[model samples]
Target: MWRELALGLAGPLSPMRQAQPVGFRAGQAVTQREWRAEVAGWAAHFAAQPGADVALYFEDSLRAAAALFGAWHAGKTVWWPGDALPATAERLAAQGTHFAGDWPGGACARVAPQPEPEPEPEWQPLDAQAPALVVFTSGSTGEPVAITKRLHQLFDEVRALETCFGSRLEGARVVGTVSHQHIYGLLFRLLWPLAAGRPLVAERQAYLEDLTRLDARLALVASPAHLKRLDLPDLAGLPVRLAAVFSSGGPLPDDALAPCAEGLGQTPIEVYGSSETGGVAWRQRAPGADAQHPWRALPGVDWRIEDEQLALRSPQLGSLDWFLAADRVRAEGPGFVLLGRADRIVKIEEKRVSLAAIEQALLALGGVQELRLPLLPGRRQELGVVLVPTAEAWEAIETQGRAAWLAPRKRALEPLLEATVRPRRWRLVSELPVNAQGKTTQAALAALFDPMRPSARLLQREAQRACWAIEVEARHPGFDGHFPGHPVLPGVVQLDWAERFGREAFAHLQPAFAGLDQLKFQQVIPPGACVELELQCDEAGCVLRFVLRSARGPHASGKLRFAAAGEGA
Candidate 1:
């Protein structure tokens, strides 16, 4: 099977050739033959708009893969944004691009996979070197960067993956918890399985509960973000057992892998690579493996340590030259042990960001004197900046207030950084947290962002409900919006606080708001009042009900409904 598959990987592309089930949608099998017909139909439509640049966004993996192949066949360059957020679409739309999938901005054209009844076109091989994809990265240094790829670049990585793990994943159906828009999911979830003749689950399995519905012979393509949250006991009741599991996009902690081993009967095959340098190395931890376990380089990948950083030479780069990576590693037992990062750049929300560049930008600003930008803990995907403000800025905060003082500082950073990499929360401090050696440490900086150390304190907590006893400071900026003479907490601020508390208390709550219902602000919550803010989550109805009360009685009460993240506002 491996030899036959290897020959197929090297053979001419046949889009309409049927070998395995491509996907299952609505209890209907989407065979490779039917998928190819849809691709050909969309290709003919796209071929009409020759030379057009199209931005593709799809919630469905099968449709996304079809559009990708269809656009490439039509000789159109496909732009893949990480998300379909309006801001992202608007920014790329300014470059005169057409939109596809369910994106709701602009007058751009949309394409759907509609398999026509016409004759199935003969399979045609694609140009190996043709520019097919343009993937945007949160710039490692400053602004966002675009990485272009030809068909061969992606195919090289896919071939490498199949060559490495094809036999073990034999007859396994592909099911992913990651999005197909990014490189990791694009290769593992869609491209690799498609090329290797494996069936796939069409919709992304967002919740762990959904995985219980899956049948047998499953191969899970997931990310560290999803795997880190999985508890061993939660996976005990899974209907089907996974044969092979793949993880990427970041380091998968040992704890996350333990559950995969216990639940799936296999250690996760963690692939270490990036969009630019695909599948550099892989490692499957043996039982009792320690942090010092080395990563084995993939076939056709040549790796060397360059100035303490990991550098690779592979066909995945579309060239023979070595591409230096941000990771630092040292040789250990025919593989390499990963050290910490050599650069000050990090990935938040799978988007690359340069901490050094952000620090430099902030130091250049008039108000910021010294600062440290630390990636927030868990999957929040945000940066919390701790700053020792300039004397002038501190004075302004005292006189002009925090909301007014912090507004311009963030606005000043707009020209230098993308919104994805921007620091969302700003903390003002008199001094920096440092070690005995006087170096600002990550742990020290992270401690400053703890909500417990801040104004909010958890008074009582339960599974779905938490009561916070908050004393709103008189000088707090949130009071600026309500009347100046009789300062009261605004309805908007109350709702925002409710949502924030709900997220902090209930870690599994989706952060997206679906709707607001029966909101009543009966009394004014004045500054300096000690109020009890209670949050109750309705998981069945997908609603979060909140009430703010004090001795003065119900200040505010409302129900804020939230959909799963990415279901739109």
Candidate 2:
């Protein structure tokens, strides 16, 4: 019956007399009647431009849903970009496409939900097999892949999800930390709840502090990246209690899961799937459940281990053909245990190296909070590592020097991994680089190794002021690939150097960074240019002002804000 309703196979719609609440916007209820009316308004608005493909980008789920359904009603398809960043806009422009979002690019006229919907717009059923949505992969492993979904495939997957977990979530209000643009968010946060008659919260809960406002029963649709940062103290006395929490996008480490279950009311149900495959398998580790719990395949999803890779055939695919996944797994009893991805294995010096195995080994080391291991460019087969040290490890480095801090940890890994597989170069950073999707990309990972972009020299020091002379050369990383014929230091590199120097010279800004503000770039510094860096720490020690100047004029200036020791953004 759910599948029939989802696939528009349930018969003609009857007029609903009373307004059923669909969601909340700014603490105000949005009714089913209003939503349908909005959909109708959008349909009429787009009908004039029928058969046009639209790139949709809405941060609000309710408005996004109205636009999506309206587009389908008008016989049009919707495209989703990986993000709304400038780079994504450039990519879309390269493809000669226009977008309909809250962004600035005026390639297409923006369509928003009507402030007040029209009265009594007629309802209509959509063609079940028409192409509906285009979703892009996270691009964590490689370039993002675009996958198109027919209405049947998407609706069938929603039905399957409801059948598997809907009973436990009945009557639960929907809340999310993840963005509605991704597949998990599209299904769980919007479509599933809409079909289940559950109301959605308008605002996205980005910070742990945001969860404190929940006062009702909730079905949280979230990702591991967000869940790992849960703060127990901040979540206390919330107006809302969680009935179920759903996590996806990446593996939920045991370290994060235990705390989440203890802090929240229930253990999270982690969904294992990708953009191409909707909801494949799920697992929830009870307080006393086995440490090596396997993920059970969803209802109607048939799976098999083919050449160590997981393969599936389900109605969600709109056919009986098996779809192969990159994940390697082993069948255990009625389910399967995922053994990393086959693509993570790389060759170094003609020797096979398992990047996953090395990472897992490194994670087992004490004082390592988070880390990423990627192979270096060229045929040398060497590896590069970006590591985020735990507070304890960072303290050790501050007190004992970097070599003393790294010696024992490196020795511990020596017994577990081969020399060829060990990372040759490592970078320590305050946090990992993540995109809007909370997934780190290969490009972001490689950018951590940017070679000595700026050389710094301490010129003078005083009680509250410090001065440094910096030099940028042609071989600097900031200049490479910035432009074909011309090269200049990027503003981000300048800010990074300022922050690094500020931390070294001032004791107050140590530990964590809050944010940067009041940034202005007046001039571009070319190669082989020498510049002066001036920094001042206020009496309160929470703010630092930095300025970069050359013989001509100021290159850049910004104010760096710091949160004391444990407090940070």
Candidate 3:
């Protein structure tokens, strides 16, 4: 192979040339080819520039990949700000040389328009150790760390794809649902397809319904977050033949795996890897499969356990030969079983507790659709659980006779209600806050119990003509027992007040108490602290709003909802 820098190199011909009909809008398809040509032109433009770094902000996956490759061909480095938040972008820009993307009002220089150029010859290879890309990982301590990947590391990763799965992806069109900015998306969707001589799908399938309209035997590159959204009523009959389903980002729960197998006629192959190590291991969701221990390391990747955590050394890491990960894994003969992340464990009452374990336990309970465990900040060890009940679970909890439908732990924990976090604080929510990749952010988890950030939308609001005002002192009698002297108002009581106000505002609305939506206890409101109550209602339902302020500081503010008795009642 020759080595040089030039964009738009024609891929090597592969024997498998099945004209796989990919599903994409005509405009998008045309734009993909156009974007490729434009990227080649941009590569030439960048070749004339001094620095070797470029920032990309394009939303379209194909366009982003084209820009990324074009920069690489010009011997430039790609800097991807995965979060894309203003603070994150500023930090990246400070260290980066040039930036590209559609972000509005940022300090980075705008990407210049591409100029037309004559068709370039095939791309020549550059030094394998040449810097190719920079990806930022969320630091264990909440800061971000920039990890660089070399050309050779990227090539090795793409080469390992064949060994990771039994099938050859030659000539296979790749359509990814995950963002190209992330490691999983970058490797599976762009590099692997390019190395295998496959044409990449320019558009991302945002919804499961979009799959039905697609024309190719899709490889459905997805994350556990996307897989959870799929509600397959009957899996035995579907038109599409999925070559394979790949899941990463987080663990694919056993419950999610079963439906994917029955519906798609193929078990989802879970991938275990991180931003640092690239691709590591693979496992299939088969009957009696061990989720914790089924992972087999990819060929050419060396693995070992150190202090209960898994570490990997691979040819793909360039100068960095070894990378230690936070995943807790135990040896299983030739392979390993992944226990949750090492950071996920918390200590309570001198006993070690796994929030992930508690979440899995709560998810196993009947009527629970989704659950999240968030730790409260205080002297006492408090675990807060936010839950969204299935309709059946909702009915069972609301009707006293139906309470038997719950498991013992769920029943015991349900009464701690919306406000207090004791053995557990259970707050019912319409839906959990999951990010684009389907992973829940710690910020989002903390927001759940935060009474300050209520999830309910105010549909309608009307001040009472004859306002019935009440000033109530906030107090949690159990707080003394919870910590003995450092008492704080329970989150459930704050939610309860909101519900009571809902009943008061919509007197004619017949507030059918559905369940607690969501609640958060930001700063504790102490006993004897006066809280002002406000109430409102509309055609959709009612809302109870509370603003609690004390001489110390702003205590908490929140809203609650009561579903209307009927559709238009």
Candidate 4:
């Protein structure tokens, strides 16, 4: 049964029986009645809260879904922030929104379980025009901006989804790697499933091995970031059969299309839109198709082009007036071809340049796995490329110096881009620096060239180990008061970084520091020098090994022992 978004929690979306599976968590089923009772519990608790706006963050989609509907049922507008970072917390607090659901810093009012909710009259359906949600953009271009969505708009979007793609996903369990905090994830991973009576998987698949372990009929809700990593040769195909696969948050790279076909058993339907626009269109690539295919408009969504920028008028836009989008497009037969983003065009040295074109050229070189070319300001504005290289390119860069591998790529791009718009600064990385939504922000991208602080960026990460490439800027505080004219990195700072990384990699263990063995500082690590810190798990139950090295040699290497069961050291 496909329930309308207007019906929401009050409507009978699923059988309200004790055994009806509402969601799946770690392979266990959560009952529909159990979830309903939790939603009622949240509503009761929210009735006592003074504020009408709640900022929510939860890694588990089902629990977050309960909190969302509960607040809405209580006449509150829920704000979905992609992260609970300090900056986001401050912003929410500034807006007088109460923190809720898995937010850190003890800022949230925890949701309580309702084993036996007091039987009362059924809840009334929410008003269709009332404000229901405020979602933040992914911050790919700049700081995140909030977009308010009304219940009527969301209800229409859900109905549209049910009308267009409902048949293929009948009774499919929704599985996802993306967090529900983002708009795309919130729709496909949580809301759509509940509206259509499909089960949702609670925990995200952090590693491909975890997804491979599942034996269920599933519909994957994924982003380009996660889908691009699934191209592996050791695995022939995923054992778990998928009913459907959906991709958004960016275009699925042409290279990743085959992996989805191989591992997922179906060509993924790519949904195109933004937080502000909801969903405007979707398209799936047919086998053997090589050219960029035009995207068909979503149900009840109408599109037009004026001055090369695409504009839309649909129920999803929340108005009849056309909402102009940032993307430039060309009309094709019964569809449109996306040219690039008109908003990303930047002016450099009295010359106009398309940052999207520059980015496309870098991506076309084939070495780049992911990248962001943002305009950096100075006396002369220049571009900086924060790039994550592919596995093949990474191996070559590690063996041959980065300059050797990057030289030919730069030579190839010299013809594709204007010299004035060429990236002046480069930060080669293993992973893109992004928020929980996998959108790289302007500040994070610019941090690579920041001279005031020491930054640790990921170079590579594996099951047993994690490696970070740290750049100690010339004016880093680690240099202060070390020597009159000469400055060296302190041993304490190096140890601190190693310990911090271990904490992240082994967070589940809650490992407590006990003692250290094999500690050695071989060479003086000077300021303004770059180094690599590698943290690895030792086979012994409680030992963690680390190495701090540079081009010169190993600066330090040691093994750290943590407290074991009932043992101090």
Root-mean-square deviation per candidate: 14.7, 18.0, 17.5, 19.6
Candidate 2 regions exceeding 4 Å error are 1-18, 93-98, 106-119, 138-143, 238-240, 287-291, 344-569
Off by over 4 Å in 4: 11-18, 113-117, 138-143, 231-240, 287-291, 345-569
Largest TM-score belongs to which candidate? Answer: 1
- Candidate 2 residue lDDT tens string, 321-422: 899887889999999998876666454442334565566666777778888886666424368877778878777876886668677667655643446456
| Local distance difference test scores for all models | 0.75, 0.73, 0.61, 0.75
TM-score of the candidate numbered 1? 0.71
lDDT tens digits, residues 416-526, model 3? 221222354445554565554666776666665554333231223454311222223233342445445756667666666565435434444445655433344557765
Instruction: Write down the worst ten-residue block by lDDT for model 4.
Output: 345-354
CA deviation > 4 Å runs, candidate 1: 1-20, 50-52, 109-116, 237-240, 349-351, 356-366, 376-382, 390-392, 403-425, 431-439, 450-569
Q: What number of clashing residue pairs does each candidate have, in the order they appear?
A: 0, 5, 16, 0
Instruction: List, residue by residue over 128-205, the lDDT tens digit for candidate 1.
Output: 787788897655565567888887888888888888898988777888998888888888888887777787888898
Error of 3 at 8 (Å): 7.9
A best-first ranking of the candidates according to their TM-score comes to 1, 4, 2, 3
Error at 255, model 1, angstroms: 2.1
Provide the TM-score for each candidate, comma-separated.
0.71, 0.60, 0.59, 0.62
For TM-score, candidate 1 versus 3, the one ahead is 1
